[model samples]
Target: MKKICLIASLITVFALSSASVNAQYYFFDGDYYENPVLYEAGVSVNAMNSLTDLGGKKGIGEKFLKDLNLGYTSISGGIFFSVSYKNAVALRLEGTFGKVSSDDKILAGINDAAKNRFNRNLNFRSNISEVAALVEIHPMYIFVDWPAKETTPPRTSPYLLAGVGYFSFNPQTKIGNRTIDLQPLSTEGQGFAEYPNRPIYKLNQLNIPMGAGVKYELSPLVNLRAEVVYRKLFTDYLDDLSTTYIDPALFDKYLTPQKAANAKILYDRQIVKVAGINGKRGTEKNNDAYFTANLKISVIIGRERIRR
Candidate 1:
C-alpha cells in the first residue's frame, strides 16, 4: 500500500511539470501571430522629359532656342506614411511638393522675339507639384514563419504595391521682369493689340499614377524600400508655350503697321482655319508623361515578437 501511494504521487508531479512547460512554450511561440504594424517615410527623384514640337518652325527654333525642349528634370522629395498590418499588407499615403522648371535657354530667343513683338516677352517659365496614395501587398512571408531559421533573427518580408493618385498643379511662366502678365500665344500680329494680357493655360490637372516596388527587412524594427512610378496627365499645355501664325485677314484687322512689320511672328502663329490655337492639328496629339524613382526607410512602431 505504501509503494502504490508513492507511485501515484510521482505520476501527478510529472504531469503537472509537463503541463507547465507546454504552456510556457505556447505563449512564446503564439505571440507573433498577433500581427504587427509598421510606418515609413522617403524621398524621390524625377527623370522628366517633354515630347512636343516647336509650333513655329522646328529647325528655326532648334537653331536658336528649342521650344519643344522646354521641360524639366528635377529632384522632388516628400514624406510618405504607411500603416501596415500582418506584415503582409499596408496602405500608404503620400504628399509631395517640388518645383520643376526648364532651362532658360530653351525659350530665350522666342522670349526675346515676343518682347520685340508685344513690347513685352510672351514667353514664360513653368513649375508643378504632385501627391499620391497606394496599396501594398507582401508575398514572401504571408504564409511563411518568421525568424526563418533557428539561428536567425526575425525580419520584415518582401512586398509589392500599386494604386492611383490625384494631383493639383499651378502652371505659370515668367515673362521679362514681370511674371504671368502676358498670355501665351495670346496676342495677334506684331504687337499685343488683339490678344489678352492674362496668362494663357489650364492651371489645374488630374493625373493617374501607377507602379510597383519592393521592400526588405534590415532589422527587427527597420526596413529599406525602393520603387518606380509613372504619372499620366490629362493636359498638353504643361509648358504653356506654343505659337501659331495670325490669319492674313485677321492680321490686317488686329495689327497696326508696326506690328505687321515682322512677318515671321505671323507665319508661326498661322494655323489651319479648322485647327485653331490649342487645337489638334491632323494626327498630332498632346499629352504628358513622366517617371519617378524613390528610396525610403521604415521604422516599425508597434509590437514585434522577439523569438529566442
Candidate 2:
C-alpha cells in the first residue's frame, strides 16, 4: 500500500508539469497567441509644455524641469498605427499637432533673479506639427512573462520607446489687437546681411523623441496606454527668441517700414528701456524642447493566425 501511494503522488506531479508546459504552447481561448503578426491603431490626447528661453521658474532662471511652467501648457492630439510580433516588439508611426506658448510678463517683481527677464518683456506662441517612427520594446515579455503558463497576455506591460521625427513650427506674437509672425521681422537680425552669422532658421526641422510608458490590456481587442515623450530640438528659435537683442536699426534695414515698427515694439516691450545695458533676449546655450503627456486607446485591427 505504501509503494502504491508513492507511485500515485509521482504520477500526479509529472502530469501537472506536462499541463503547465502545454499551457505555454497554446492559447486557451482561441488562436490569438498563434497569430504571427498583429496590427493596432490608436488615438491620443495630450497636454503639451515648452522648455524655451522664456517663461520659467518664479525666481532664478534654470534648465530643464526647473523652468517648467504649467501656466503655458497647451492641448495636443495625434493618431498612430503599429505592428507587433509576439507582443515583444513593435514599430509605430504617428503624427501629432499642437500649440505651445510662453510669456515673460508673468515674471514681474523687483529684486528677483528673474527681474532681468521680466524687464526684457518678450513673448510668443507657436503651432507645432510632427510625425515620427518609433520602436517599442517590452522587457516584461522578453524576461518575465513569456514562459508563464497563463492563458492570456499580461494585464500590464511596461515599455520603452525611441524614435526620429520631423516637425514644423511658426512662432507668432501679438501686437495690440493684431497678430504678427516673427520670422519675417528678423527681430534678432536673422537672415540680415549685417549679421552674417545669423542665418535664417527653417520653420521645419527634425527632432528626436524618447520616453517610456506602460500599457494595460483592457480586453482582448483593446489596450490603454499613458506616456510622456520629450522632443529634442536642434533650433533655439522655437519662440523666435534666441541670443542678444540686435540694434533696433537693423530691423528697418532688413524689413519693411511697417514690419520695422512692429518689430521694435514686439522686440522690446519693456516699460522703460534702461540705458547703458546691451539687452539679452534669450539664452543661446540651450535649444528649445517640448513634451507631451498622453492618454491613448488602441484597438487591434488585424492579425494573421497560424493554422493548427
Candidate 3:
C-alpha cells in the first residue's frame, strides 16, 4: 500500500510539471487563440482610375485590370484607424484622396455605332476625396505568423469589405492655357427653360464602396495588405460627360457674352458637331464608377485590451 501511494504521487507531480511548461510556452510565444481585442492604425497609397462613358476601350471587359486606362491613373493616399476583434472582424474609418480623368479623343477609329462619341470629343479630370466607415471580415480568422509552432492558419488571409461613403468631386477641362469647371457652364442647358428636366448635378454625392483584399502578417505588430475597392457613385458627372449637347444659342441667352463664348468652346471641343438638339454627349445607360488599388501597411497600436 505504501509503494502504491508513492507511485501515484510521482505520476501526479509529472503531470503537473508538464501542464505548467505548456502554459508558460504559450504565454511567451503568442500561440494561444484567445487574444485581447487590439487597436491598429494604418495608412495606404492608392492607384486610382475610373470607367465612364469616355476613354476606356469600347467593349465591356475586365472590371479592374482590363478596364484600367493608365493615362488617367492618379496617385492617392489615405489614413485609417481600426479596432480588430481577435483576428475575426475589424471596423475601420478611412479617408482617401485621388484624381480621375479620361478623354474620348485618346482612342481613335470610332465604329459607325459609336461615331457620335467620336465626334463628341469630351474630356475631364476630377479630384476625388472620400471618407468611409468599413467593416472587414476575415474568412480565415486564424493567423499563424509566430515562429516555433504547429498551426493551421497561413501567413496571409483574404478579407471582404463593404461600406458607404461621402465624396466630393469637381470635373475640370483644359482649354489652351486655362482650366475650366464644367458644372457652372450648364452645357446641357441645366436649369434653363429649354431643358428643365436636366438639373445641376451636385459636386458632393454618396457612394457605396465594396471590395476584397489580402493581408500578410509581416511581424507581430505589422501587416502588409493589398486591396481593390470600387465605388458606386450617385452622380454620373464625374467625367463631366453625362448628357446630350444643347444649342449654342442657349448659352448666349443664359450668360454674359464673354461667358457664352467660353461655354461654346468648353462645352464641346469636337472638330465637327453632330447637328441635333440633344446629341449624344454621354451615355445615360449607367452611372459613373471609380476604383482604387491600394497598397497598405498597418501597425498594431494599443495593447490587446484597449483601456477606455
Best candidate per lDDT, number? 2
What are the per-residue Cα lDDT tens digits for candidate 1 across 84-151?
64456666666655554443334444544322222222233344555555667777646654434432
Candidate 2's displacement at residue 84, Å, is 1.1
Show where candidate 3 strays beyond 4 Å: 1-34, 58-68, 109-116, 142-153, 303-308
Worst 10 residues of 3 by lDDT: 20-29
Against the true structure, candidate 3 reaches a TM-score of 0.80
lDDT of 2 by residue, 36-66 (tens): 3456789999999999998787787788899
Clashes per candidate, residues 3 or more apart or on different chains: 9, 0, 0
**Deviation (Å) of 137 in candidate 1:** 3.1
Candidate 2 regions with alpha-carbon error over 4 angstroms: 1-25, 28-34, 145-151, 275-278, 303-308
Across residues 1-308, which tens digit of lDDT does each residue of candidate 3 receive?
34334533544454344334322121212433324355668899999999887777655423445655678888999988766654667767788998989877766685654455556678888899888767789877644433235453466879999987778899888879898888888877877888877888999887889999998978667889999999988877788777787888999899878778888888877768565667667766678899999999988743332224
Rank order (by TM-score, best first): 2, 3, 1
Task: Give the TM-scores of the predictions, in the order they appear.
Answer: 0.54, 0.86, 0.80
TM-score top scorer: 2
Model 2, residue pairs in steric clash = none
Residue-level error in angstroms, candidate 3, position 170: 0.3
Of 1 and 3, the candidate ahead on TM-score is 3
